[model samples]
Target: MEKLYQVALTMVEGVGSIMFRQLINNFGSAENVFKAKTDKLLKTPGVGKQIAEGLKNKNLFAEAEKLLNEVEKQQVKLFFSTDKDYPSRLKSLYDAPSILYYKGKADINSVRTIGIVGTRQATDYGKQITEEIVAQLKPYNICVISGLAYGIDIAAHKAALDNNIPTIGVMASGLDIVYPAQHQKYAEQMLEHGGILSESPLGMKPIRNLFIARNRIIAGLSDIVIVIESAAKGGAMVTAEFANNYHHEVFAVPGSLTNKYSEGCNKLIKDNKANIFTSVNDIIESMNWDTEGKVPEKNTTRNTEIDLSQYTQEEGQVIAFLRTNGETQIDTLSWQTQIPVNRLASLLLNLEFQGIIKALAGKKFGLKL
Candidate 1:
């Protein structure tokens, strides 16, 4: 298994997905391809004289194993596309990666997975909307996937963790490499729940073209993609394009007309490239997904007729506040209800401890019911 993995890594090095597919088909396995002579390698589908010569000179199989060993010492798991645990969504793509490296516990073959992508430079509105979507997807057993860049990517990951949903970070760089540098800690947290995934081998830079290829894997690995915010030309748009091309459902949140970050998403909805989604239910229905087992159980449901005498006035007031507003800021609630911030915090905390309200990002509280 390890040798096949190492062999696939060699053929895919510096090669695009299509070429990698051709090589895999002609060679039967990465092991055989790596051991093949130049002329034999050239007979493989996509292998030109130059590519064959390149393969012959370098001992990439050994190099890949060495680099992967370094990653294993960091406790990362090297995953392959042929592995039984590989995502079925990805397996169906026309040009799936020859291999993928991962960390953490997300079962790639799980029934639910959603890709959340958007602009690298996000505004406050974008961040807020991304947080809401992540929280909504949490109850639906959705595994959030992103490029793990800045802005919306980090926002999506953080919100997923905050809401207790596992998320996957798909990088254009190698598994051992953490691109964007700023997201290393956030990536670590993802490892704690879902995991980090990448098609590129170690020591590879996350250049422009590489990212475009990575985008396809992201789209192909997901059943649906929700674009939060994006510029007219952005990596998020690229992922959406791949999603559409792959016959996966694509949804975008409409943003302000004048906002630069929203143009790409707005255009998608306007052009019918994607459906407009405001809440998790919209996406679930559009994708024709049954999220019955995905959502967290609701316990805060009150018996409208008989629950009046069961709780104190303060607790009742809190419930009413949550039901009416959906999610309220902790400080805002204290101000509106004339309760001290600390006391209000405690009350809300207790409510959550009792499975009444689901906590959203940035101190916002919403009822689970």
Candidate 2:
């Protein structure tokens, strides 16, 4: 009955996600919000005359009941913001949805989650990079999250499916609607491995405003956000902004400055809004993912490549520091060498990949000698 009132409260004309949160928090419950008179509702912070008036609509409960029945018939799962299964990351956001509907076996709160987003008009380069990143992240069992839009978002989901990794598509429409329509098959297949999620209730259209709202969930569900490719203005950039605001790690793949599609990513890097993405190893190293116990054991033998002539200037600087200091912590090396921590992580990963430096326990680095 409380859940029904919660659903009905969402139907109030002037109420939105943030407003819903405020109302519930102030009144102590959704039912309480409904029970309170207009004067009482007005006393809540941010609730004005019009919004408080909307709160008095008694007809919304019938609509809520109908939607709840539809959800039940369709076997869709409903999670209120306060539910135990509600995404913890998303709950931290000030404007997170009051209700979420999903269908799938994937856990929204996976141990490691990443969001890959780019422009809808993804270039071939964007598609390829998206696939490559998802493929590489598979071993870590990262949950790939994205908006179920066209281009890069679809590419990320498809790549995760191809790599047998869990991928979630946060929809701009209702759970019953697939926005692009053509990718319904992809949505269906994802349920076998991941899930399609949304805050919109049944019969809701995929409107422009809804997608802008949808982007927040894409950012919220992620521990990190990677902009694979994006133009100067797009939803991908919006998602990146949300991620940065939420204090999640944001990365952008550097591409040629001449390419128009790369402008958003390049700008993000240049503005110091995102770390430069060098490789999947950079993410793993930055996240400090545990490979020792979680992933399958690999061959312990080191295939050392002793050649140092090909190292970049940054790589050389890191190598030189490790050699001089014997064994140094990553933070210490970053401080001594004057490399940003993000860039240092990438450099160390490159050196480790070439067997030039070995990563020790506790993120320390040493020259292989």
Cα-based TM-score, every candidate? 0.73, 0.79
Whose lDDT is greatest here?
2
Tens digits of lDDT, candidate 2, 1-369: 998999998888878888888788888899989899888777777888887777777778888899999999988998887777777677657678999999998888887789999988889989999999998777787899998889999999999999989999999999788989999999999999999999999889899989988998998888889999888889999999998876677899998889988999999999998989998877887766666417423323332343446777878777666655565556557656778778888878887897788876434677775
lDDT of 2 at 269: 96
For candidate 2, give the lDDT of residue 105. 87
Report the alpha-carbon TM-score of model 2 versus the true structure: 0.79
Superposed by TM-score, candidate 1 places the C-alpha of residue 236 at a distance from the truth, in angstroms, of: 0.9
How many pairs of residues collide in each model? 1, 0
Residue-level lDDT for 356 in candidate 2: 81
lDDT accuracy of residue 17 in candidate 2: 88
C-alpha lDDT (0 to 100) for residue 128 of candidate 2: 94
Error of 2 at 298 (Å): 24
Which parts of model 1 have CA positions greater than 4 angstroms off?
1-5, 8-15, 294-369
